[model samples]
Target: MEHTGVVHKIIVAGIGPGNPDYLVPAACKAIAGAKALVGGRRALAQYAASDGAGQHIMAVTRDIEAVMAFIQEELHERDVVVMVSGDPGYYSLLDAIKRKFPSECIRVIPGISAMQLAFARMNLPWHDARLVSFHGRQPERSALLYQKGAVMGMLTDAKFTSRTIPLILMECGWPGEAKLHICTRLSYDDEKVVTIRLREAENYPEAKNGILLVEG
Candidate 1:
């Protein structure tokens, strides 16, 4: 779909995980200067105290249609900014939006993703790490990517916590012998990182948003 008409320009910016410091200056300026802002609840919360004047739209899920419709409306008469969690390119809503809008009219501002923060906290070199997300689907496929001596970065859901992932790995024949680093609520005040053996993780409780790093 070719979006030709000048609605407002859509500035898709990433607001980091949940920390303001991680928010890049350019992204902060874009958001603060925009006439309108749109994103999920978590994204909106990060800018709750901003003095900038902009309308906020918090979608429940990946309601691309609704978000696009809102974007179209904003483009008609104002400079619009959309906030996405982590980097917009990392399994985010950017691709869908870009599919509908022309590239010339859309600008993307990248931010620090949870995977980066997770690896940073663990002091692990992620150059060879494989990243995956189980946020809206089953993590079985993701588990298969975890091979011996390979580093795996995973985005997990509430139901699939630090512990649940090990169960999946065990079922997939992942040698019950790997180091597991589970980062939950990354970049947030209550953030916690737990390390355990793949077999021991099964006994842990569930967490909110999680990033699992498995290596052998």
Candidate 2:
């Protein structure tokens, strides 16, 4: 790829949970000097005035092609920063970005994931938990993960929530008596953490950013 007499650069930065407080110094430093910012709408809004000032802002949507085009255009002139929610290594845009740009030209700065925040808020060690994401997937696909008794961390979405997920797990063999730790809007001022049995989760509403802990 030809650049403006400069090596093409792309920084895949993990912006952490929604709150600015959770953003790590390394990621913050990279964003400070970014020429173009590509991330979800919420992330751009969070840093728009500070790190995103005078930078080309592009919201990543279902259109992956458009995002790649925008990044490429920016790369020809200057470095571009592609931000992802949570740790870039997790179920994020890191893999897609890697395929679009050369590995040598890309640098990744990891940040705290919502799941990590969820575990932290609940004061539970997470290494033993079976983690899953139902962001754009079906629970039935990961049927084997719903063991009768096990520690599980699930990253939920609008379609999948405490209202729906707990019942789905129960149908997949999880016991109704199992505890559900519903951690929502982590790292933000409005963050909420609640505990209830899996059977009683129907009363809770959906959360755009939430993690559900299914503890045995």
Compose the digit string of candidate 1's lDDT tens values, residues 70-138: 777777788678888889999888888888888778889999999999999999999987777777777
Name the best candidate (by lDDT). 2
TM value for model 1: 0.88
Instruction: Please give the RMSD to the true structure for each candidate, in Å.
Output: 2.4, 2.7
Regions of model 2 farther than 4 Å from truth: 1-6, 49-54, 140-145, 203-209
Write the residue-wise lDDT of candidate 2 on 11-104 in tens digits. Answer: 9999998788889999998887777888898878776556445779899999998998999888877888888988999898989878877787
lDDT value for candidate 2?
0.82
Q: Which ten residues in a row have the lowest lDDT in candidate 1?
A: 51-60
Q: What TM-score does each of the candidates earn?
A: 0.88, 0.88
RMSD of candidate 1 to true structure, Å: 2.4
Clashing pairs in 2: none
